[model samples]
Target: MAEIEHPKPFADWETRAYWEGCGRGEIVLQRCGACSKVQHRPRALCASCLSGDIEHFVASGRGQVYTFTVTLQNNAPGFREACPYVLAYVELEEGPRLLTNVVGCAPDAVSIGMPVVADFTAPDRDLAVPRFRPA
Candidate 1:
């Protein structure tokens, strides 16, 4: 069997800190310095305050499962080996939700409101993706 290559995530100037932090084992989230509202999806302006005073901060990396789906199949290239994985929306303790894979447990064992912590996968030197597992 051949090793499967993982998909690399995209990072732009507005969100560079996040991927960089992930490589360093930190979960980064952005906060609006103007109004103090924190958010994810790493945008230029705040969703609540609409201010451009955004700053990235390291997060606690603990969250509850807001939702999830068990992926029994993946047609995309390099993703077949990842079948039977748990894809989930984790609601962070810092008040943002991140779309991440829930690992370290059976797909059938995942549930909404389940406590989880961040894990990381570094496929290359330049990036790392955050995953989650039951806490």
Candidate 2:
């Protein structure tokens, strides 16, 4: 089995709870209390309403592939094995487009509006990264 070279997630005060949620196999996202908008890349405030009141909740883990590209090469360590993998932006059912990798299917099969679901991969104890696959 080959390893996919994905970026390490940022661990900070604003995002600690999110990573913890991933460890428990939940796809988490932030929702704005003011606008009821979902946002990825969790923050202290809502991006849509700019309100400081944001709530973290588990996502349905179902989404659609908004866009994607097949990478033929990578310079990052341990990422060469995933040269032909699909890197995609998935639009969650919750209404946020998140940056993630699409797997469990042929790269050629990936297309816009394709349905997908979340898959969590932990390369190390402290890291839990979210990848998506064909639903």
Candidate 3:
């Protein structure tokens, strides 16, 4: 079996809340205090209003698959064994589209609008990757 290559937080102050929320089994999204719009890919300022007044909020961990693909080729050595996996863009309940892996179903069975819920695994690691399963 190939070694598991996990995701770690970016070395930036603005991303601290996101990683910390994950450690606590929470899904955090950035909300613009000015425009009141929620977004992902954590940053200091809101993408819409460019306002530095932003706050962190936890999501419901429920979403629907906006799009997805079945990856049959894993070029990376660590992920080679997990090939033929499903990578999806899930439109979270809080409004941000998140890139995540869709598990608990056949790779070929994944489809648009399929409901999914967040599942946290191995939180003790330096990095905790959020996974999803059919709701």
Q: Which pairs clash in model 1?
A: none
Candidate 3: residue pairs that collide: none
Candidate 3 error regions (>4 Å) = 1-4
* Per-residue C-alpha lDDT of model 3 across residues 1-135, encoded as one tens digit per residue: 232465455536888788777777788898898999998999989999899999998999999999999878877765677877888999998888899989887888889999999876667654456778899
Candidate 2 structure quality by residue, lDDT tens digits, 45-84: 9887799989899989899999999988887777787678
Q: TM-score for each prediction? A: 0.90, 0.88, 0.89
lDDT of 1 by residue, 27-122 (tens): 999988999988888888999978889988899999999999987788877767767677789999998888888888878999999999998885
lDDT of 2 at 111: 97
User: Rank by TM-score, descending?
Assistant: 1, 3, 2
Worst 10 residues of 1 by lDDT: 1-10
What are the root-mean-square deviations of the candidates from the true structure over C-alphas? 2.2, 1.8, 2.0
Number of backbone collisions per candidate: 0, 0, 0
Question: How much RMSD separates candidate 3 from the native structure?
Answer: 2.0
